[model samples]
Target: MATFALIHGAGDAGWYWHLVEAELRGRGHDTVAPDLPCDDDAAGLVEYADAVVRAVGDRTGNLVVVGQSLGGFTAPLVCERVPATLLVLVAPMIPAPGEAVTDYFANTGYDEEPGGDTIAVFYQDVPPALAAAAVEHGRHQSEARLGEPSPLTTWPGVPTRVVLGRDDRLFPPQYLRRVTHDRLGITPDEIDSGHTPALSRPRELAALLDSYVEAVARV
Candidate 1:
């Protein structure tokens, strides 16, 4: 079984991945979803990666590192420190080496895109009760990490994959297509959901993750 080291995005803790974790565990895989120090102004990208590495502790074999949204920047750094079998990005903000997190939106033209309603953009497909809880669970994201350049000097050598939600408003599908292509030379696999697919479509997300393990085995 593969161990999925699931990393959540900005302002969110490991709680963001709770449902997806359940689905992955049900499929008989071990999973680690750590609460990042996103609220701590002192915590930067290195600290972010440190939390995940420590959470992983020394388990070996078939590590699949999955990152969502801003977690994208931290995931690649984890691969550099772990024997990750594959790196999966779910609606991620793919980063360039040395690019600061704050610069990401403007550098990628995300700032120019028209914004949408908060509910419609991020939690449109999520269950109402759960969505409310998610909002309540959010923490204050700090600028310490956002202001620093991503310390990934180079992308890790592990095989990589990108997944994008077709109905995503926060990061529109068309926009992500260009970002993924320009940054990673990849065409993301599309899913029928909004930005937070783990909460909105956990089963389908789990299945897609499982398929990645199968694909790696084939290689």
Candidate 2:
């Protein structure tokens, strides 16, 4: 069974992947969703990747590292440290080497895009109760690392995939398409959900992830 290293986004905890974890576990795969030190004033992307590596320990087998949103910045770092078999980015803030996280918006022209209400952007498709719980589960995302450049000098050699939320408003589909292609020369696979698909469409999300494993095994 492959071990899925699930990394959450900015201000989010491991709980963000609970539903997806349950689904994966039920399908006979192991998953690790480590709570990043997002609230710590001293912790940055390196520390975030360290948490995931520590959680992984010595487990051996296919290692699929999945990162969401801001976690995108840390996922490749993990792949660089570990023998990751696949790197999957879910509605990610795909980063450039040496680019500060804070500069991503302006660099990608996200700042020029039309904006939406926070809730409407992130949780429009998520159920109200679960979305509320997601909000409560959020922590204070420290700005300590916002100005630090991403440490990845080049993309990891591991196979990579990008998944896009078709209805996402925070990073709209069109925007993500442009960014993904521009940065990675790849077209993302689209899903019929908003930004937080783990909460809004766990089963579908899990199935998609599972399919990747199957596809990789054939290679």
Candidate 3:
């Protein structure tokens, strides 16, 4: 049985993955969604990765590390340390080799106000009224982390899965598809939900992942 480590996106916390984690557990899979120290600050990647590694503890079982949005930057690092069975990217913000998260957002087309609760609203998928709720709960990330580029010389050869939010207002589905298919050479599983599938569409997201896990076992 493989353990699942879920890393959340920016302007968000481990709370976001609660539903999906429960669902995975229900299916008899081990899981953990750690709270990264990324709040109002931009959070450096090294610190974020270290936090993930720490939370993973000494569990030497087969692992499935799922990185959501900003979490994509840290997931690969976990893959580097542990014996990862899979690296799953949920509409990930994949930083190129030696490229930082800042690079991805700079050209990401969304407007970045860069201050207080205002920044949270810009990245949230919930309605305007609920977006504010995320601000308080969201952890303050370190700006230094955003500047630290992902340290992957090459893609992890281990099995990888990517889940795309079809109606993702943040990372357009088509764009994500292009990258996963044409660029990465992997046909990612698709979800017709928003950027926050674990929150917005937990059932669908979990069902899809359940199927993939089964599929992987047979391979």
lDDT of candidate 1 over 1-219, digit per residue (tens): 999999999998899999988999999999999999999989999999999999998865889999999999999999999999999999999999999999999899885454666566689899999988888888999986588888999999999999999998888899999999999997899999999999999999999999999999999
> Which model, 1 or 2, shows the larger lDDT?
1
| RMSD, every candidate, angstroms | 1.2, 1.2, 3.7
Per-residue lDDT of 1-219 in model 2, one digit per residue for the tens?
Answer: 799999999899999999999999999999999999999999988899999999988764789999999999999999999998899999999999888899999899885343666567788899898989998998999998779998889999988899999988788899999999999999999999998899999999999999999999999
Better of 2 and 3 by TM-score: 2
lDDT of 3 by residue, 1-219 (tens): 667888998757887787888888888888888888785354467667777888888765767889998898888888887778778899787656777677765544445233434434233555554455556667655565566567766777778889988767666777777667754787878877767788667778878877767777899
lDDT of model 3, residue 161: 84
What lDDT does each candidate get?
0.92, 0.91, 0.74
Q: Against the hidden reference, what TM-scores do the models get?
A: 0.97, 0.96, 0.83
lDDT of 3 at 69: 88
Point out where model 3 deviates above 4 Å. Answer: 40-43, 105-135
Error of 1 at 7 (Å): 0.4
